[model samples]
Target: MVAPARLDLDQRGDTWSSLPDHDVDVLVVGGGVTGAGVALDAVTRGLSVLLVEQRDYASGTSSRSSKLFHGGLRYLEQLNFSLVREALRERELMLTRICPHLVRPVSFLYPLKHRFWERPYVTAGLTLYDSMGGARSVPRHKQLSRTKALRMVPGLRKDALAGALLYYDAKSDDARHTMTVARTAASYGARLLTSAKVERLLREGERVVGAEVTDVESGETATVRCRVVINCTGVWTDDVQELAGGRGQFHVRASKGVHIVVPRDRINSETGLILRTEKSVLFVIPWGMHWIVGTTDTDWDLDKAHPAASRADIDYILEHVNTVLAHPLTHDDIEGVYAGLRPLLKGESESTSQLSREHAVARPQPGLISIAGGKYTTYRVMAADAVDAARPDLASNVPESVTEHIPLVGAEGYHALSNQVETIALRQDLPAWRVEHLLGRYGSLVEELFAMWAEDPSLKDPVPGAEEYLRVELLYAATHEGALHLDDLLARRTRISIETKDRGVTCARPVAELVADALQWDSGRVDDEVKAWEARVAAERESQTEAADQEANAERLAAPDFRNRSVGRALA
Candidate 1:
């Protein structure tokens, strides 16, 4: 076996093409959760896999989630039994067997309007939800009186509901989990490349054998051969299928879900609050130092790449969430704003919100398969099914997926290490909170981060602007994770984009420098990286101000690559 390249080896070019002129067992497109999971599953089963993405990993909808790894409680309201059961199982698998470090327990209070009727109604649903996987490790729902609910979530309006239901769901940093999955896949032996767009699918008669991919970073193209090509492009499933010669069995519709991040102090909350909106659900989720309040559902017809959160969209969130807050939050309270497109299964509906989150898998042709339209909670099932669909085309003895049993890179022994955080902190001479923070993000892998700091104590300090994140993390992003661009390091690898006031603009150059040194990038490359990132921020800011989705799409598409040097002091 070829030794795995250090994840920091600038995963920017054709690592696959260098080895041999051979066909891989599977080719997975899209680097979102599903695609990443599929790569990991396929590789674990002893299948040679090659996965490609047009942009950075998690650049699309996968990164911009409400950060929850929960079974859809709202879906229970819709009486979608099968979907709920499947999601609950995946949620359990993630929390228990897979990504324990990345996925954690989060509690939400469900406000009940009509004192008696609502409580019983919600309680029955909660009972069944908890019953899935037969009483999860997390706490079951507790009935809260109106007064008790108010105390738990002080922000809720006084007269909104007679009572609320407090239930347990899972939440995660979506980008981190997605990247870790890809990294885990790499560790197991999968060749994954980001910013390498599939120009066209390579085919044998009507069946896809592989893809003709173009490296978006280096401007190089390579023909990668594979036996089965799985399209897991989320919202871009249709596009990927069409590139595979229009053979995919199902189509995906892009539903826009926008989220806003605000300071924690804005709303007093003992538990994260989940409320029902007219069109969708609104969650005041408890993120580390902030509260994630948002998710406006609307149909998106504009730019699939870089979907912008418009003023109206922001207003819609602020308006609805404000109604529930004791002290209403405004534009001033918004620390970060992001929008993601959901790949809802296309069907007969003008409203995207009503569409199903259930995933569809198909072997449209002999060697081509596509999986699309599922919530993050169900990504594992979606991926396993994709691999199952590709089984007939595979040449090797297909082993059953072991991902359900394999812990992610940082997950193994995480619990024991977390208990020993204080000892780890004292030995390392770091703050207990800081060490704990590292453990939360990296799990047992906190030792790796501490080791990086040990080699050079200077790495212990935080970045100039994004102090919430350490400088060592930037180095780790490139070295241990396959971070190829400045934006990739900051935006996906770290929460710098939402954590800071400048939205990672101020730290871009320094972070770029850190990445360049690690990747051995020359001066010309540094300049290019910096320019592209600045342009990306500028384009996003410009796009957010547009009147409608079309105009916003037009403005955002103007900056294809994220590193434009132009554009100044923008209102985030």
Candidate 2:
């Protein structure tokens, strides 16, 4: 097997210089999971592919998700059996064959309030859920009495439940998983570009042929010729469609989802919890040393780029989850907070919560195709469908997508390395727990980090303020992963931004200085990056205090984007 491609500064320069020289069979316009999956599918099917993202890969809604790979249990209530079945199939594939290193099974306790009717009703639904996707990697749903449930969860209030149902689902680091998908696509010979925006579509008398691309950092422009352009821009779908000189077939509405992170000990549950709300469902997921509880689904019309979580949003989540908790949580308990937007296909329903999660692909013109509106679990299917839509436009006979059998970059030898964690720890002179942490994040790719550690011992030191991550991880983010800015490294690459109380502010300078050499950032550049990140954190903090969405959004937009700086010197 070929080694995964390095998306370092050198590769970025080369790819940029060669952009206008050749025309690819497919030009995927987005860096989120759907776009990344499309790139992987297209390249593996014997097509020349190039994927470009306006910002960093998974920098938008892709990174900030509920981080689950389950068939939507709530969708079962909506009677969307087909969607649930499809998602469950993908969930099984992710756990066993695809990216097992990143995705894992997580059990959730569904507390039953009504004694008689609720148990039987929920039982029937869960039974159908278990049977939908065959041959599951996780155990089936199990019924638990109130006593047993309280024994398992001790944090729940005594009167909160008469009984409970424990069901299994899969969870993952969404940002990391999305980035891995892009890297896997790169490994398959797809040219991936980030911080590159598509200004407009290049057309030949109504038949769209290519796009006018701009390097967001340097302000340089290039025309990328392609056989077909697949639009996977998510919430920015309409903007891309407008660039194509048409409204396209549909519209995409943005829905805001807010989540708060707190220390794991604050929620004394052995497993995660799922609660039903009036609008939708709430998930209190286990995220390493933290518990991620959230998600208030409300219509967001303000800013698509940086969706801010209002004070009201946080209160709503706390209000709902507090109903069942033995000790109610307050604002002081929250360590980190983040908000993400969902790109829903605009339907007749005014409520974003009621909108469809099912995706749609449209070929508005001869050479252009747009795909929108699916959940993260079905991204592979969405990508395959998008590629299938582009087949008619391709001059040559296109092969069918084979991404189903393909394992992501780090999945190849993950289980074997997992078994050798203690041996690896002894060999590297590190603690067993540290080795386990590294293995969980990088899987078989932990060897790459070990190789770096062998060269520079200091790289193995834990990052200050966010000791969970090592300095080597930040270095790797710059050298191997395509991290162009400080936000890219902290927010998406390592998730230190949302895992720590200070929101990565304390470790900002250290991380920037560590990656300086790899990114060719001088002292001035480093200072600028740190200041920008600090301002962003401050802005987000201020925004979270506001009661209304507009007020919060205005505050979040106060920070300056550091990546908007001109590229005066070429990266080494």
User: Candidate 1 on 1-572: residue-level lDDT in tens?
Assistant: 22333565645444645524756888889999999999999998989888888887798998999899877888888989888888888888888878788888999988877755777777898999999754377998898888998987777789877888889988899999998888888888888887778899877788787788886755767888888888888888888878866656778888888888888888888999888888778988999889998889999877787888888888898888887777998877777788999999988988998887888888888888889888888888888899988989986578787778888888887889888878988898888888888887888777788778888998898898888888998999888878877878878889888777678888988888877878787877677777677777777778778878888777777664542222222211
Candidate 2 segments whose C-alpha is farther than 4 A from its true place: 566-572
Going through the candidates in order, what is the number of backbone clashes in each? 13, 0
What digit string (tens of lDDT, one per residue) describes model 2 on residues 1-572? 65988999999999999998989999999999999999999999999999999999998999999999989999999999999999999999999999999999999999999989999999999999998977379999999999999999999999999999999999999999999999999998999999899999999988889999999878899999999999999999999999989769999999999999999999899999999998889999999999999898999999888999999999999999999999998999999899999999999998999898999999998899999999999999999999999988895678888999999988999999889888988999989999888877788888899899899999999999899999999999999999989999999999899899899999999999999999999998898888888889999999999999999999999887655753223221
Off by over 4 Å in 1: 1-5, 10-20, 563-572
Estimated TM-score for each candidate: 0.95, 0.98
Model 2 per-residue lDDT at 233: 94
